[model samples]
Target: MATTNSLLLGFLLLHIAIHHSVPVEGHPNYSDALAKSILFFLGQRSGKLPPDQTMTWRSDSGLSDGSTANVDLTGGYYDAGDNVKFSFPMAFTTTMLAWSILEFGGKNRMSGQLSEARAALKWASDYLLKAATQTHGKLYVGVGDPNSDHACWERPEDMDTPRPVFSVSSTNPGSDVAGETAAALAASALVLQSQNRTYALKLLLAAKDVMDFAMQYRGKYSDSVWTACPYYCSYSGYMDELLWGAAWLHKATKNATYLNFINSLGANDITDIFSWDNKFAGARVLLARKTLVDKENSFDPFRFQAEDFLCRILPNSPSKTTQYTPGGLIFKLSSANLQYVTSITFLLNTYAKYMASSGHTFSCQNVLIKSSTIRAFAKKQVDYILGQNPLGISYMIGFGTFYPKMVHHRGSSLPSISSHPAHIGCNDGFQYFFSGNPNPNLLIGAVVGGPDQNDAFSDSRTDYNHLEPATYINAPLVGSLAYLAGRYGSG
Candidate 1:
């Protein structure tokens, strides 16, 4: 396997040598390119784009969904490959975005990404404020029914289907969604604190109130809307999110109450993997950050657990549980597993940097764990996604010369037509899921569902699970890419 990997790496380098413009190695301007990729998703927003955003492909979409339901839902990002906005995942994406900005936004301020990130942050943060600050603090979880939105292939701006809204209240509780939103707002407050102190305080106060609501009334958002289970289900329950929200609040405000809540949990209470549903690993990472950077030993209670998490995910750790693709991606699931790989990559990369900054060192499997080693491991995953594997194709659209043209996305695949046209050519090529034709519009910087466990990838439009791109995936990619560009000179 080592010999085969070396041969493959040689071939990939040679391929890039011949095709200089390919995004494999020595690609200059990756920082700017990655920043643009993040902006691409923000521009794909269904509602109004901020003044700084020069959006063209999509106009106002699902604006009336708020008016019809008498609730403000004019902002927030569209979920993967569809127009429906699932608040649970959307809020999680916002929290990650804000965290990324808070972590590395200062390093690449000259790239103008800081401004773009701030725009994206405020867009989602403002929408979250609206969602949480409703009558009697009821937070809406799902906007636009998934079934109704998936029934037809129409632009979000032109859809005529019922855009139903779902909410979580004291009677209908949703601790997972509520807690994640609280985390998002809390992190957003930190992102905005330097520039807009007033807005940041407003977000923090709201986050505290919302966290209280989530803890006081505990349940998953999917309980209220049964249809949301298959899409944004809380498989790991709400305790992780509650702790996660409290952790972020403690970090942002340094309040002892929030710190007390986090210290109350057991050290081994965390799960290894971090995702939209699972915040245990992420909360641990944040806690570890506080311990290392702030020199605050007050987090002594979680010190052992944080060290355990770091060791478990390391390449040579005895407790390493994450499986890898044959081509070397940290695989977790069977389908579109690259999303999980990329998300975990950011965490590992950030944690490694934290360790490096603090001059921390440890021995695993007779090999010393250093920041450079951890970062090198994280960089391998980035290269794999950008055409270093057996398939040798970039999963992120418009990054490399070769990529998937049929990315199972309606907005990019369907023709842009004005006016509401019912059943407009819906049956034209629905049968042949792998449309021979390229997508009508180019969704640049949009990374589609990635390859399978065996490094097998089919660039087909029919395979939604393997071709769809979600905001959560892109959120982590932004941070990882930024960190890479800063650490290793782009191009």
Candidate 2:
């Protein structure tokens, strides 16, 4: 006990020393720290607490949600600040997580995030396998009752609410969800292939089956289920998922059919913004990478669409598309806008790396999308999220000294001390309560819903869009930050 206490004291002192070293009046060098922060964020949002994991802040979560629908829904990551697990976005996040590791894991492996990244991805992949196999060909798309889950403000570990599960069948299709899940499984197969080839093949076969089901059915899940609307809805339509799933499937397995399918689609309706709901941007990037890196001249048709889309996102395009804040964040929707910007940041960094490697300059309408330009824009976006913006506050939790304290996350807001013991659970009734003080446990590394157009922000628990953090928001940031840190060396 004495030795342990001494070690703890030493660690605390070291932390304080490093904390004081951060520049008081400049953009703090938090790239390395922020990379670790992203891992912590994922760890906290994990559904099932592993034995080796040490998340003292979060009690064993998603235990009650286990065995819902008589299926073991025990090993996926939580969707957002809420306890629910929407498998569509959850799988999307997992796909990005695996992609980050595969594309940029070398430096991260040295940085100690690779293990956490693998564990996080495995957690979701395991759940996806169960979700796929339990119901034969059809996959479980959505888990948890968002209506019931959101009604209570308690932690996932303490919840006694209804834990219902939802799925997609051939008669009732969910192309977006199933396609995204296939993308996740396919991407994860690459990550796991070398480590465990047997399991990797299982993921591949499952991905093939899931993709086949999704393509064969060909309809958005949100249209079929009223509960999935507006929250985890497919805003950009379902065709994007078909393209996205094919792109991933092609990447996982060098299949000529997947390439032909994407080629037949022609110029994709360019949605300038991308998110969990939208996979067009992701699909375009993945296809472009394949075209550039392939030793053979296969998938060469994708080069045009990829270059076209890339040029649109970059500044100075003839279109002059993509709105930006005064602080320089690529703004899309007013609600929780950082999610959109961070997603773009990750994509830009990825394309930039690919462009740099290809040594070929891309232009659209005579506006050059050079490697330097892409890197500069991506770095600026990253800087804004850190502390370089007008507000001079980092959007990420537990990074800079100043960040959102009253985040609109139930898990972060619940009182550590029970003022009224009887009112702990939503047994009698419930009223949405926001704690007056800062969150008791720092949801470290969480990138909250960020500032407004004019760089205004309120650290109020009532502001849901501006304060709540989600896994999708942080997932890209992890990959983005890792790329930046590996390229430039963390500050």
Candidate 3:
């Protein structure tokens, strides 16, 4: 009897060893977790984060005493730390975070990252509930600093005197707020519902109010006050994001109204951009292809837009372009643009769907190779940060230039052409750019610059006074780092 038992145990041990020896693709957990982690980290790595210690949505009272009201207007405000607070910018950021987290967590659970997955689920739940409760039936441009004595509509005149009017209005709207906010809320509700049916249903009902408000106002996208101008509208270059939120809402509620709304926007309006905005469109396109393709939805605009942009930028070959720099650093440019990594990644995942629906393939291997290059570049940038580079001067690789500043354009502020680091104003604020990299190894992203060197933004002149982390730069970093750690761990 003892000999027989020993033989059985030996056989069990052999079976386990053989399982461990199999390749990762055959290991369901390995494949799923890796995919989830990569997707979440990629999405997060696209945005900026706050420079100051305080979370963006916290009551403004605790902020530094002398901090300017205009500080909230800077891009960093959109990258606020906590998801519990729901303001306009926070709402947008949180929605992106929640979707990524939930998706990652679900994959993690399947891949055996149970604890981490649960934490992500919990964070998403708390955020969605808080956002739903705070907004109730109405969506403002975003939440205000709770500590401020001013009303939601109040704006400061020249950073000193406060005006009675609210800078954001639910009615008489201006920027992409109506579309962007509504889409975010709707997506959040849908995700929550998929996870927790009861809670999600309630949130969906509440979210309908916000959607209704947005739908009631069918004004031109240019009238959106939340963003700066027509150039910033989702249609100008980011219709995908608007569509992503809308698609999720459509899926969650199974509401024909949302589908009809999206259909009316038409595909011709979608523009191709390299940022997450384009991913949003890809995501929605996938959703639409899944749920509405058979419902007589028009395909003309989507085909035209996809062909126009994809054909124009699709690289003919995987070639690298180099430019000489006065500095020792080598700038790497590819046939594919780095800025379009987010959109390209989305397309990679969803291309089959588009092909089936539209009979066109946006096959651009350069997009994928460029993304890998950007990931490599991100590692170098992070190294530069940890090395104590002053004022966090980093380059976007392909451009061979430092971050651009907001310059006055047609009576409004817009990101100017990329310039050298030595030209950036207010070098103090640029240091935050060195925070994290896109690699699984956090150290890989460290900035290698020496401690004392000053970049362009460091000037004590007017440029310094106007400099701050743009929202586009900061939110993605925070989201990406957290997503990476949660998904892939230190490896």
Indicate which candidate wins on TM-score: 1
How many residue pairs clash in all the candidates, one count each?
2, 0, 48
Instruction: Between candidates 2 and 3, name the one with more favorable TM-score.
Output: 2
Off by over 4 Å in 1: 1-29, 50-53, 365-367, 418-434
True-structure RMSD for candidate 1: 3.9
Whole-structure CA lDDT of model 3: 0.35
lDDT of each structure? Answer: 0.76, 0.76, 0.35
Identify the candidate with maximal lDDT.
1
Model 1 Cα lDDT, one tens digit per residue, 195-270? 8999999999889989999989988777777758677888888888988899998888889998887766552564
Clash total of candidate 3: 48
List TM-score per model, in order. Answer: 0.91, 0.90, 0.47
lDDT tens digits, residue span 1-491, model 2: 99999999988866653454434343445466545555655444546565665545565666655476787777677776777778888888888888877877775432667777777778889888888888775678766778887777776556666777788888889988988999999999999887899999999999999989987897889887666876788887788888998889998998988778777766368667778988887888787776676534565556666666667677777865777788778887888999888888888888888878878677778677788888889888887887667766778887766777877776666643233333368532224354466777667778888999888998888788898888888877778777766655646
In candidate 2, stretches whose alpha carbon ends up further than 4 angstroms from where it belongs are 1-31, 42-47, 64-68, 108-110, 295-298, 416-423, 427-432
TM-score, candidate number 3: 0.47
TM-score of 1: 0.91
**lDDT string, candidate 3, 125-195, tens digits:** 34334433443343334322432311111111111222111233355542244445555555555555555
